[model samples]
Target: MKSLVLCTFLLISLAGCAQNNKKEMNQNYSTEEQEVINVTDHLTELMIAKDLKGLNNLLDKDFTLTHITGYLQPKAEWLKEIETESMKYYSFKPVNRKIEINENKAEVIQQNILDARIWGTRNHWHLQQIFQLEKRNDDWVILSSVASIF
Candidate 1:
């Protein structure tokens, strides 16, 4: 029947459109995910370079960094460490990195081994870090972070 033939054509067309839409969505997600990763990478670079102003611009006002030793370092204290070179990071190797983005908020979970000098001691530590970020005025800013040693 002509009606059946037309219905089949319509269904096929709709399926193709659906597949295209899905592919576009996946591409969009990939782009957004890469943006999040870039932000995180830039933050790390700022820390490594002891760029206080850059870090300040990227960190939210209420930012907090919870250390593996159960001590909470507020933004000022963490920046001070970087400025004084007391907590110097030499290198980091990210083992497992996962990111989740929900609308204007994102969370990045990373498992990494870092070589750093904390206070006066130098060591390589395997750490799990969770970072929370929010889009503020079209720019992603880090809101908080928690790190645990493994």
Candidate 2:
């Protein structure tokens, strides 16, 4: 009877440990996802603020932006538009967001309603943006993006 009780106790203890480890793993994934989300939020904030220096730090050297009109803009041209106030963003209302991470690379899809003025014309647009990011030197940087208007 004593041996039986001892074996049962050991089994319960092991099960508890397994449960705890699983919970820890789930928490770790959640933390990683949140970190990615925070980086994306900061990117939008920088765009709205027109912080060119901050944007420069977040964007990779080969960053490219594909517009809804199917035109591709390199980092320099995109930065020039922001600097010249040609693409002015008043606000962004995120409708849906999804993120996927694989090792050091991540992709984020965001659907948003944007209140903006482009080249002196006021517009409210429903936009879908796909952002690709890479982790470099312990920092997350935007690698490229494609944007479409719906």
Candidate 3:
């Protein structure tokens, strides 16, 4: 009974999220919102491609990545993990997303089925990240990311 219940729960959860490689979500986004989306999309690409330098250009100096386990990983350490492949991202399928901007700050919530090997566990994680970004010199740069399950 427990096994059947667990399987049913898992299936229901996966049904709500994207399982394909089609990345784009909504087409009627405002121009400002689209700019913010572009930044985050580039971020995902950089992560999967393991381009640390390019990723650095898009993040703030005091950037942080908060994992689902509530571990607050500093940017330097996270980059090191990516460099060493302790955290390796393969691909992302964004199912749902939203962006809100106030003045020069933007908050983006994105849910994706991400294929990755993290800390030796490889799975297609139903990942959701609340990313904080700030506009500096007319460019949107990620300040932090708080991750959770979809």
Q: lDDT (CA) for every model shown?
A: 0.85, 0.85, 0.92
TM-score of each: 0.77, 0.77, 0.84
Clashing pairs in 3: none
**Shift of residue 94 alpha carbon in model 1, Å:** 1.7
Can you write out model 2's per-residue Cα lDDT over 16-124, one digit (the tens) per residue?
9877764563354466676777787787788899999999999999999999889999999999999999998788766667889999999988777888787788788
Residue 131 lDDT, candidate 3, scale 0-100:
97
> Which candidate gets the maximum lDDT versus the true structure?
3
lDDT of 3 by residue, 1-150 (tens): 999999999997776543322433656688899999889989999999999999999999999999999999999999999999999999987778889999999999998899999999999999999999999999999999999997
Which whole-number lDDT from 0 to 100 does residue 66 have in model 2?
Answer: 96
Q: Cα deviation of 91 in candidate 1 (Å)?
A: 1.5
Considering only N, C-alpha and C atoms within 3 Å, which residue pairs clash in candidate 1?
A: none
Separately for all candidates shown, the number of backbone clashes (residues 3 or more apart, or on different chains) is 0, 0, 0
User: What's model 3's TM-score?
Assistant: 0.84
- Considering every candidate listed, which one attains the maximal TM-score? 3
